[model samples]
Target: MLAPFLIMLREGVEAALIVGIIASYLKQVGRSDMMPAVWLGILTAVALALFVGTGLQMVSAEFPQKEQELFEALVGVVAVAVLTSMVFWMRKAARSIKGELHASVDRALSGSAFALIAMVFLAVAREGLESVFFLLAIFQQSNDALAPLGALLGVAAAVVIGYGIYAGGVRLDLRRFFRWTGVFILFVAAGLLANAVKAFHEAGLWNGLQETAFDISHILPADGPLGSLLSGMLGYRDAPTVGEVIVYVVFLAATLIPFLAPASPATSRAAARPARQKV
Candidate 1:
């Protein structure tokens, strides 16, 4: 529940931030007339994301057990990729995002509405698609029925928070927020990667080292309250396969080390700079 919420909140704020920045730039340059096109692009991107998510869900529902596991594994892999890229890309793009957006706006002003719409569409669609993948992955992993509600509320809160930032009512340290959340997201991604491996094994696609890594199922069942919490948030399988444990630990070591390592001078400076959300 909390996993999807935070993921969606982060993603939602990012999409909102992009739209806010573009809207502000338009007003600054006396091209506020272009705002409608920007919105149209955003809506179009949103529609595309919804269409894709719904289509995948509808198709996957008809699959047999093994095929469904394979499908889930595929979704988990894509979600991990999307989650990792979103975190690292934001770290790299934070500094130059405003300037790039401004440049795109300038180019759009020189051309046609199609250009402006395309720009916003592509930008927002990235976030939308990321959300779809992560959300679907979360839904696929969880046994809880309320996960969707948590996700919905997260998006709602993000919209409110994003608007507050844009309207000058919120003064969050976005860099810190993202840093903490990035840590959390890396943890989640590790869990997803492990689960994906487990799913692959279940689908009969990969069947090596099929030993039980550990068995705490008697004490902490995966479906119980505390167990489910850990399972959802940290991918804690009570009796995880040896392969699952190996991938989880290795993924964490690989990603967490680099993520927490010191940044270069240029990256430090750029990440130090706060996102300019106020008009």
Candidate 2:
């Protein structure tokens, strides 16, 4: 529940921010009349995301048990890849995103109404599709039926928070929020990677270091309150395979060290500067 909640919140807030910024930019440039088109694009992108996600889920539901395991492994792998790229992309793009978006709006307006719609759709679609994959992965791993509700609540909360920010009712340090949440997401991503490896092994595609790493079920059974929370959030297992443990630890180490480290002076300057290209 916690896992899906936080991830969806991040994705939703990002999408909302993009929409808000685009709307604000449009108004600033006396293009307020085009807001209906913006809304159209956003709604269309959202619909497409929902359709794609539902289609994937329904298709996956028809698979046999072994095929299902393999599909789960593939989806986890893709989710991890998408999530990692998104995290780094946000880290780099945050600094100049506004300027870049404004430029995009300018170019889009010069073309046609369809161009603006396409622009908005493409921008928000990335976030929506990313959220879909995250939800799929989380739903697959969760045992409780309330995970979907948790995800919906998270997205709702994000919408409210986004409105507050846009309306000047909330003053948030977005960089700080993203930085902390990024660490949390990276932890979750590590767990997903381990889960993917285990799924592959279950699918009979992996068989290396299959020995049990440790057993702590007596101390913290997965069904317990705390255990379940950790299991859902960090992919905790009472007794995991050696491969899973290795991947989990190694993934955390590789990602966390660089993510938590302070940006170099040159990198900071580069990020602070607006892009020279119109795009």
lDDT per residue for candidate 2 within 1-279, as digits (tens), equals 878888888888888888888888888889998898898999999999999999999999999988888988888888888888888888888887887898889999999899999999998899989888888888897785778888998899899988888787988788887888888988888888899998898899999989999999999998899999998998898999999999999988988888888889999778777754433
Which lDDT values do the candidates have, in the order given? Answer: 0.87, 0.87
lDDT of 1 by residue, 1-279 (tens): 888888888998888888888888898889888889998999999999999999999999999999999999999999999999888888777766777787788888899999999999999999999989988888898776778988898889989998898888998787777877888999999889889998999999999978998999999999899999988887788998899989989988988788777689987666545434321
CA RMSD for every model?
A: 2.5, 1.6
Give candidate 1's whole-model lDDT: 0.87
TM-score, each model? Answer: 0.94, 0.97
Error of 1 at 40 (Å): 0.3
Model 2 CA lDDT for position 51: 99
- How far in Å is the alpha carbon of 274 misplaced in model 1? 14
Off by over 4 Å in 2: 275-279
